[model samples]
Target: MQVDADFRPILGPQLVRLDPMRIKQLQDPLVYSSIDSLAKLSAHCLNLRAPLTTCEKLINSDNTLYLAWKFDEEQNVSRLLGFAKVGRKQLFLYDSQMQTYEGEILCLLDFYVHFSAQRQGVGKQLIDYLLAQEHAEPYQLALDNPSVTLLGFMSQKFGMSKPVWQNTNFVVFDELFQSFAAENGEKAPDGWNRPQTPRRIGAVSTDTRWLRNAVSGHQSKGNAMAAPVDADMTPQGALSNRAHQAKARKAHILSSKPLW
Candidate 1:
């Protein structure tokens, strides 16, 4: 993503973290425009009707976007290589053992690497940076409507082979449940199978993104991995999108799972 003006002075030649407060403090239109443009492009790449990420959502939500930059000395221009947006969200999550809980969990919102940079480890670098910052393992995180490509990435990079499907766009891995069980007693406490029954390991500041989108049609009832339905990455279903209400159009579901 190229901007008219050089951003090396503002962003430098390193990965930059952008959040509501950081963006506000900078008050730079170029930064906003560049971010918005990259989001639009990412949405387009994911075959979405609208951009999943927007300036308004970032301002209102507790999302953090990490921007990977590339500075061309000859061109004297700084361009965005990729970005990964993540945040802590309170969600009704189902674990691998069919247990349900409500808590503020870290989520991978959006990830994108430019076409020119794909397969060059840029995407991995971005995700690694996110994990390092959050001090989290890949299996312990929830994915918002992950696309097929993203699913493949997880399978290949982190061996997250099993994903516990939820009614909403979010999905969790079996290891998360194992981790929770190991941390809180030997297994999920009795009555944890019911919706929002058990408490998570701990609490954190959670964003209200799901609650805000509850009224929308995209938050359809039932398991997202079930067959004959549209794709899974509805909210932030793809590597490029996250947290926004997915389009109503029917297309392909990346993969299906049992109606748990």
Candidate 2:
């Protein structure tokens, strides 16, 4: 998409979708020809609200994980405007206390816009675009205290509230909220758009219930497929489950301690 002149500083010329291989290519010293600059930019984000403890873990993250950065094309080399990294992790301990959580997490492990890129909408654009991707559900993005502002921005924009994970940081309730926004429409202050054609991660089709049961190794495969919902399972049931979980988590965070 073209970045209008008014939105140029906040957004780059276009949003490029990078896969694992492409991210590695850019990270390579020889290909990018600006490893030093990229490293510096990475370091700058590393130094922001992310505590030293959390930053170290990111620097040592596994090689297989995918990373995507947003850039503004000038003349020669593109400027590093902002970035986002996504990968599947069983748990992400984003604080010193080592609080853990579950699910196949597609983390927004790192999101940073250059000082010059603040407020034009680069961060919002990058995030909104990423959420619209082919695989969008069961994702959880953890943000540090300072990055909580982005959380608020997304909450108002998406008509969802940010849920604190461990009283140290907050996470956007990806699956449910995305479902809500898709069923509804964008509510963010900047008039950002939600991605069309939402798809949950690992979904073969709209029949995710059947797909999941088959993978879980239940003894009665035939019966499981026939009754997509047992007495306990249904689409409405899943929504109710999430609502209960959210309420419990909110109480846990607010009652236990201040998430400052």
Candidate 3:
């Protein structure tokens, strides 16, 4: 939708990554208001019962909203064409053949182009940019409760047909299920989207407190007992797996050369 004020001075003519930390630091009133309106527009276009996105929810979660902006000379302002919200989701996925598996996937949560920009390739532009940045293909993606329109779009654009059913709202296509089966018990790499158990509310994080204290020239007391994770909130063995994966990710980062 076209706004009265120009966002060109703010977002520029590029695909922008809108994350919690960036928005929190920028502190722009127009940015928040514009994004909120766009999200409502998205919900309306998709016939959702309620607005699926808001600044309040954005700041509280790990999801990223990617926006494609276009300068509308007729309106004398910059218009944001659409946005794609994505994040890592842990799910129990089921294939058509009844094979079940647990995996973490990059999920397409919500996607919509503004009514004014629909059918004008704005959606494709946003998707192309997202796929490039994520280093992912359409088949590798999971969709969260996609509308029929979106499902048709996937079929047309990426040849993605029937999806594997999920226990939750999310769904992955047959290609992903086939890939998992073909892997033959081999595990996916740490950086390639794996479930990381999030620390529970009351659980103290077993962080590198000793290292930090030592760097600050503070002497630590004798060893303190580690707090147990709340099993009620945590899946069994997930904590240990997450720890191991975290270490593996760290090692991979240190060993890999800089992409930039």
Best by lDDT: 3
Cα displacement (angstroms), candidate 2, residue 170, comes to: 6.1
Runs of candidate 2 with Cα error greater than 4 angstroms are 1-13, 24-36, 45-77, 92-102, 137-146, 167-260
Residue runs of model 3 more than 4 Å from their true location after superposition: 183-260
Highest TM-score against the true fold, candidate: 1
In model 2, pairs of residues that clash are: 10-120, 10-122, 157-188
In model 1, the Cα lDDT at residue 77 comes to: 70
Candidate 2 residues 1-260, lDDT tens each? Answer: 11212332322245655554444444433323332344356556656432222222334554222223343346334445555555444432322222222224455655556677767877767777777763563234544343556566667665546354544354645443444346544332232222221222222222111111011223243344434423335678778979987987898788996433
Error of 3 at 229 (Å): 23
| TM-scores of all predicted structures | 0.69, 0.44, 0.68
Question: What's the best-to-worst order under lDDT?
Answer: 3, 1, 2
For model 1, how does the per-residue alpha-carbon lDDT over 1-260 read when each residue is reduced to its tens digit?
66556787787656777778876776778778888888888999889998878777898888998889877777777677888889987687655544445566789888788777789888888888888888889986788888889888888888998887788888788877666656665433443332322222323222211211122122236534322433543334553343232331222233343323
**What would the per-residue lDDT of candidate 3 be over residues 158-183, giving only the tens digit for each residue?**
88997765668787898876665475
Q: Per-prediction count of colliding residue pairs?
A: 6, 3, 0
The 10 consecutive residues of candidate 3 with the worst lDDT sum are 207-216
Q: Score candidate 1 by lDDT.
A: 0.70
What shift in Å separates residue 119 of candidate 1 from its native position after superposition? 0.9
